[model samples]
Target chain A: AAFLVAPLQAADPLPSWNDGTTKQSIVDFVNKVTEEGSGDFVPVAERIAVFDNDGTLWSENPLPFQVIFAAAEIKRLLPEHPEWNDNAAVQAFIKSDVAALTANHNKGLLEVLALTHAGMSTDAYDQRVKDWLATAEHPRWKKPYSQCVYQPMIELLEYLRANDFQTWIVSGGGLSFMRVLSEQTYGIPPQQVIGSHGQATFEMKDGVPTLTKTLETVFVDDKAGKPAGIYQFIGRRPIAAFGNSDGDQAMLEYTTIDNPRPSFGMIIHHTDAEREYAYDAKPKSSGKLITALEAAPTHGWTVVDMKKDWETVLAE
Target chain B: AAFLVAPLQAADPLPSWNDGTTKQSIVDFVNKVTEEGSGDFVPVAERIAVFDNDGTLWSENPLPFQVIFAAAEIKRLLPEHPEWNDNAAVQAFIKSDVAALTANHNKGLLEVLALTHAGMSTDAYDQRVKDWLATAEHPRWKKPYSQCVYQPMIELLEYLRANDFQTWIVSGGGLSFMRVLSEQTYGIPPQQVIGSHGQATFEMKDGVPTLTKTLETVFVDDKAGKPAGIYQFIGRRPIAAFGNSDGDQAMLEYTTIDNPRPSFGMIIHHTDAEREYAYDAKPKSSGKLITALEAAPTHGWTVVDMKKDWETVLAE
Candidate 1:
């Protein structure tokens, strides 16, 4: 089919991925899928694979970057929400004191998410996310967060999709949040994003069907929840999985576990501190790629080195 | 520009939708968008139009037909859910007694939805919907429910897309349920279907991010809620709106009210009782099309007589 040939062209849709083991691995997978009569010619149904957003597809430096965006959004939204002036969590967010946020990062971040994301309908949340993405820049890179996406991984995504693989981003980030930018940045549509969600009620408000968010949390697609999110969102077990941190370990393990045919799992190791912040197995910010690294040989998982494998970092 | 032409010639994309009005509407829209001089030329960002599923795109004869499919699915799923044997609502669904269901349809349907759709994660619900859709045949039509799709409307959808309009299904049915067959039947991808949804909690059951359904309702995309759903899901007001009943009037009004350029608001009035079951003002099943008819002149909504507009009914 003509569709099969589109992915076979060696010229990378994202040339910035460069050429090395990571790029070669991506090319080999495409070849296997597109080449007829090859032992690895995966049926289209089983060809669907999913990846994580933050650390897997791009760099998440200076903090889980979405948090920064959320914090900024919360501040921008503060005027509309005057109650935040009295609320301790909202005050900390508006102040932009990392110490105050890190003092209770988990709860404080949740508070920020609640304040910014909750109360409004899901549609409002999506619009806010889109609006923020249009202007929001990475704190350190000072570029639009969309540009912060990894060049090699972006190539891999388009390459896989070109070869008849349907790729999805199964992330712990909020579904509405990721959906706002996934199609533009990753080529994955909103339906392809499976992630954390907030509580919603189906109601007719002034004759409009609205999905209003509640303070209550629905599902958080992180850590061990990655694999479950994949199953819940995609239904079929993914033939391949990609991630960069311990949060993605369960997803990796789930993908490579005893399938009838060959399955793939790859981890993006942060080795280039100059180009991007690199950390693994540290006390507070350890991305926990070490455990997956040690298990790779036994589990048949592919561990990718950012410094050694990728020729380029970010797509221009 | 090359990218736009590739998908069109790749396959006989809309073999079913080849009629005149439907086909020309699409061509005109696409010409406007792709060409420079057309006043209705929409930028890619704003080139979005949403449609309702069920009666709008396909035959909804057997009572919002998806509900009928769900009823059968409940029967098949009964062994897994033994509680149905003792539960009154479940028993009514299992026994297939409309009289019993009518007595308590709202609560009964809600109860059935809860039991049938609950406990399992979102993915499971999607799979169940898909499985039922694949095999289940409509009662009176005795054809695959997917085949029940309107041939002319399908043409309209394809024509609009050829012009660069991104079409979406804003339905009152469950999002996951409609998503199962939408891509194959309507060519509108799963992400494009915005409909009623239930609350789902993200939980790690055996190390996966599983979205378990809570006994809570999310947004219901029907009636005046159509506009809200379009704004929420698609992020823009539609240039064109197509629907069958009064449930879609708000969407039409919302689309046509105060638009800067030319827009279309269409209503598919079920007037062919001989060819297809026709009822405009039925007390029970009309779904409020009367108000739309009365307001059509004021709203400038085009009332489409199913008997007149469609040259063909179902996709052969």
Candidate 2:
């Protein structure tokens, strides 16, 4: 004589995602990997999922948010150095012309960053970045930049974590810049962040231990650098990866195509002009989703069309 | 009326640690922070503890184990390049005189590492290290180096983790070298390890993504570099720090001294010659405990006397 035992109700794993194949694929992949005694079941320790920061998690549109922050930094420092205007790139950025900076394929952006972000102790620079993030707002959204993070992806990050995946942010964004808001915004702590970085020399200035930030490019984590960064930091190939652009193509290829595990790759396509912005293989889009968009079919990557796949773009 | 119930039995947290102030202090600190409705309670997420690898967690003498691995690597690579014998350092290392290498104060050791360990893909190097560990045995103990791990510290790590503290290893050892065995040896995964690293370039080899190791010295996580490495990798300041040498002094200072938390710093003093090799404040010792030995008392740091505090050293 056995009494019927009621099972605990499972909440929506991804509350913001619409009922579609993109969401269903993600759910199926997670289920297959997590089910104990199943053929595709992966141990919890190997359940690693990496995410590209700029476009995948938040709006990198208009431009990647760090670019805007660097431009603003240039504007802030412009009053001290009148000679900065003589530089064509600096002048172009100050005038609010995104194409002038983007025209050089991020060379101008790197130059702007070098001019504004180096030559200070990491602590001092941390304070400055903290100050900027406190007041910085997106131009089109008219809200704080942190608030512009996609609500659907936030749910996804939590969902992956709930499924025993150690979620990480593998970004092309400056390590210092993203570290400021990563923990608070995405629930991914700083230790879990792997990104592009500038060189810093460890020295004792006035007998006080300090890490002096230098203007040297040590690692630029984009395109091919993504896989390298992952190996250097995580030391294991991720079981899953998510990104939105060709810059993330190397990471996606490394994750889904190479690893022996039952892995997942995803690309968030900005196909909703009214909700977000629709730009793929276009001239003006910051996150140019071209190679990844074209290769998604062959790799079994889930391409999430923002308009149809996301029930909510941003949290109210 | 309520029936009286016996309190749940508490498991002994440090079975390897003898009943003394050293063991008592650890229990007191953990209790203060974890006690519910207590004034000193710290949230579980902020409970970070960092341990220096070599002497703190395992044996560093007769030498730090990684250096032994590197010397062995030099010998293995000698057959490929006959001309390397011309170099005084390589010739000295081949002779197996630890004094010949240590006399140069890590400069010669670094040369040995760059010559033998670099120029291969990280994956290849990882496999080589893995292969070496599988066959290699400690010279003095006649056991695998992985078996030399301190039993008391293992208990401490488990005790901390059970209480929600995330433990990390900020070692002066080679990053790739330590990662091969960290998960199996210490229960700390590769991603939790922050150590010295050399530069590597990312390139596709016949359409396969590979990271080619280079000879360039990118970072050395020692002395002041420990704090800097912690900052670069973890981003957040740890609340608990442990070490056994002067090399870890800065990390302890950065973690316990600077951060505004109820932090703890403990130094593992090598004073047991009967059960284990004991050498601190000596010229020949690689993990020097001189400066840190003197600074411990002033910082309210706990000094674990190996002979007195531990009932056993290695795991049974």
Candidate 3:
């Protein structure tokens, strides 16, 4: 029986997954897919799966890491934007006052994004993001943003890829931000990232055709937006979707909306207060969507309790 | 001698390469990188190399195929825009008259792109492009657009990947268009594609955060724009660059510029009149840029005579 279960357990790429229902659930699904005669044999084309970055694959606590990067970039860029120094958002951002910036986080975040990401070609913004990611360390973790990725999730991604599932990162974070690290951390290439994007323009600068950033907004891959982003980016309903907050509810909902084969949706509830903060149903920042949470049982979605389910958090 | 040559050739992944200065140059570079004792052994992080898609990896004959796709999409969409019936550019596009569209090709292409790609979110646009590529047959080849890929280039892509080189397609064509079939045709996932784009917006529609297209111009990756696109998308300069015609000249120039190890630049000159049309320095559409062609010799760019160098063409 142990030998038989070995094959079943080994089906999960993350074999070291803590012995919990979350791990068991994943193992069962893999068994179903790998079983020669199982009804859930997914075709190669439909085997594509997409996950939200930030809160989904790793911790977005203490603020989305990319947001912090943007804030820093905005401060650096403030010298150029002399008028911005007087601007309320820019001033708050320059001061590094998290309270002020998060007072109206939505507007503040967008302002920071615009300031840091604007005035350059899409290519320039991308380069800036890459340059920043190469050196920037997370405030709490003191690790390179790339190094802050969750070990269990990273294993899950590799495991999925080994099983012929093409994984992608669809996040609300800036596309450029995610593109910088997706290839190295998640093994998902830059092209596989779909996220919020600012407008870019084609212009002749010094007699060269360049893509310049415009003051126009493109897609913002965020809450209630995940399904739409998936529809746009992947062009298919993901057979499997994993997310960690209410922002991911729609993606989960969209994934479970009746497909031919067995579909799986899992939510990582941040229940580990010691390793990571545990807060849900809060008024601000990754607030849990009560409706989706309540309906998880009926919808066949697995609600993962991080404290109980994950034996380890960050990858060494 | 045969035994020694076989081992040496086998060591190089691109073995079909001609035994000449060009072949030796490639072999020398690969040997330096793969040989443990060599000083040029680059770790995986620095091994990132990007490629230009259109004429570099594949043929862009009979005009950029993506432009043709846009034309077809625009014709299909024209019925909905009665205003376009009287519009000269749209009228020209509807009749499938290349001359009319080319008379003002930039604006005309923009019009077609705007109409075909606008109003939909970036996600929706990608889906439309994918659907079109699946069913739409190439005008001349009469095969699915995805099947029109160049065989030699496909092998080259796989060959590079086998050696742990990450290949990307940076084209002047729309990102969405190439992304549709890139994975199937070139093994390049959609995320590795960087191309021309249209404007998009972030909005909450029907209780979902979505990216909607606006009738605004974004970046057009062409000419000097190639380097910028590669920098923005891949954040690294390519060690090897391949292209045909002048549109790819900037990319070739950019790739071969001041790299540490041996860098390569190759141009596929269209000389096969029978297998494919051969016209350089002609006033026709897809006319090659003369300055880049003239500068090739001085720049150490290997000019490949398609008729002579290639054993096969198209992915048949």
Candidate 4:
């Protein structure tokens, strides 16, 4: 909340952003909304910007990072869960059998998620996640997951924050998982990272109090859940929303297609096969860009073609 | 984020806090954590201070302010729910029958809470709550609930913020309810307010999306739930915590009883019956200074006796 008095630099806040309408729109909107005495000028407190984590801020290609982490964690914990030896899916995961995991993907994924995340004290689980992140790398890129963030988007986060907007991450991924990396990667603090959460129980362990996670999903923040999560976590509607998938459709609608206030919503079109993976109209059950993409034109949402608009992708 | 650089005022930030050991302890703790080269220096990101809302920040006497609002909300919505006429507790509530409402308090209170809070879209409920707050007054004080906040605690909140600490409210009140008033009443924003929450469902109503409240307690942020809720909402452990009740015991213990960083846990002893209301060791379930009170001396918590420690109660 404290910023030293410094003159605004002539240098662009979003250096990674290419010279395009996609970037121009953001700069123009921010300038318009922040100009004092202008009709569009918003108070500092109401300048909330929400960004979806999975693809909007970083790459979620191949599979969501949390899913990847869950699979790896299942492999690591397989030695402890000896009873799962009879299960084909568990064996497939342990053996890195993608075919079997895909065959029983739902069942397999559920076991991995439940076994790896639940049943531990939150403090212990945080340490486990921290340990995992220190060593975990993306399957295709082989880079640390933390460094997989989009440089352009990272610039955007700093730019918005510098202009007095509090940037938040609204994701369908586990809240616990996203919180661990939000501050480190995005400069968005843990409190501002609202996502799906599971039920937790409080108990005393040897005279010390601790909260243990349960397998039950308390909230699944996706699709419509995005807006719901935003509403729950932040009473004020975000004036700016960014996302890359159909999961963020409602949030974008809630932001730009709103009844009141000047708002902006943008979708990062993952259309670069060279720099990054490209797939928007994905298979069944994927939050394919069909609905959101189709409606983007009328809502005035900026759909950034990654191949054309981005000068660079990864932070590196 | 936009505050002009000014020299730190030599005047005390907490003028309402009388010169005493309790006030000095708070000052010392903050200085130790914030001074750059100090052994206990905590980074600005780790300077999180949590406060229990009801009695800690304001007066919760005569009934928690939320319960009072719920009772009033029940009266306002009774016309729509004409069947409530058959309920004696509802009738007593309507006629101000303290005996009847108190006798069947649990069931009656549940009905009031469910009828008033559940079944409405969060936006509509927020509006309803806002409207009620715009007009409602504390039954005893005959003043707005927002105006009843403690002057000393308000100073403490601002003081901590000025010292580079992020302040959060961890309350047992409805998250939605507290959020509606938090920003307006306290400097804390809705995102910084963590409290008990009810289950809500995301749905589309007439082509517009809305999150509807459900009649289920997802998490109750009292007692053990305090620490659990803190861990859920704010993954970082709080370095400083303040409360006025036994319900806050677990949180105080979690924050300051035993931890790595230099932490401070302080309790506001409501021992000024003349100025406010004095009732410690409150019957079985109140925020009676019992478990927390007993543990404070050994844990080095600063217990503030309102009559002696505060120059004034409500901010003038």
Superior candidate under DockQ, 1 versus 2: 2
**TM-score of chain A, predicted model 4, versus the true chain A, to 2 decimals:** 0.92
Candidates' TM-scores? 0.77, 0.93, 0.76, 0.93
Q: Between candidates 1 and 4, which one is better according to DockQ?
A: 4
lDDT of 1 by residue, B129-211 (tens): 77777788888778888888888788778867876778888888877777778878888766577877765555445644456
Q: List, in order, the clash count of every candidate structure.
A: 11, 0, 7, 0
* Candidate 3: residue A237 Cα off by (Å): 5.1
Interface RMSD of 1: 6.1
TM-score of 1: 0.77
lDDT of 4 at A67: 72
Ranking by DockQ: 4, 2, 3, 1
Per-residue lDDT value at B259 in model 3: 61
The local distance difference test score of model 3 is: 0.70
* DockQ (model 3, Cα): 0.11
Better of 1 and 3 by DockQ: 3
Encode model 4's per-residue lDDT on B81-119: one tens digit a residue: 889989876776677554555565466666667778898
User: Lowest summed lDDT over 10 consecutive residues: which window, candidate 4 chain B?
Assistant: B1-10
lDDT for position B280 in model 4: 80
Model 3, span A1-316: residue lDDT tens = 7887777653546854688788888878866776666677877667777788876787776777877787778767767778886788877776666677767646776777677777776667777877887888888779777787778888889888888888878788877777767887888876567777754544445744455664564566776567655654554557888877677777776676545578888877777778867877872355455666776898788888878877778887
Report chain A TM-scores, every model.
0.88, 0.95, 0.90, 0.92
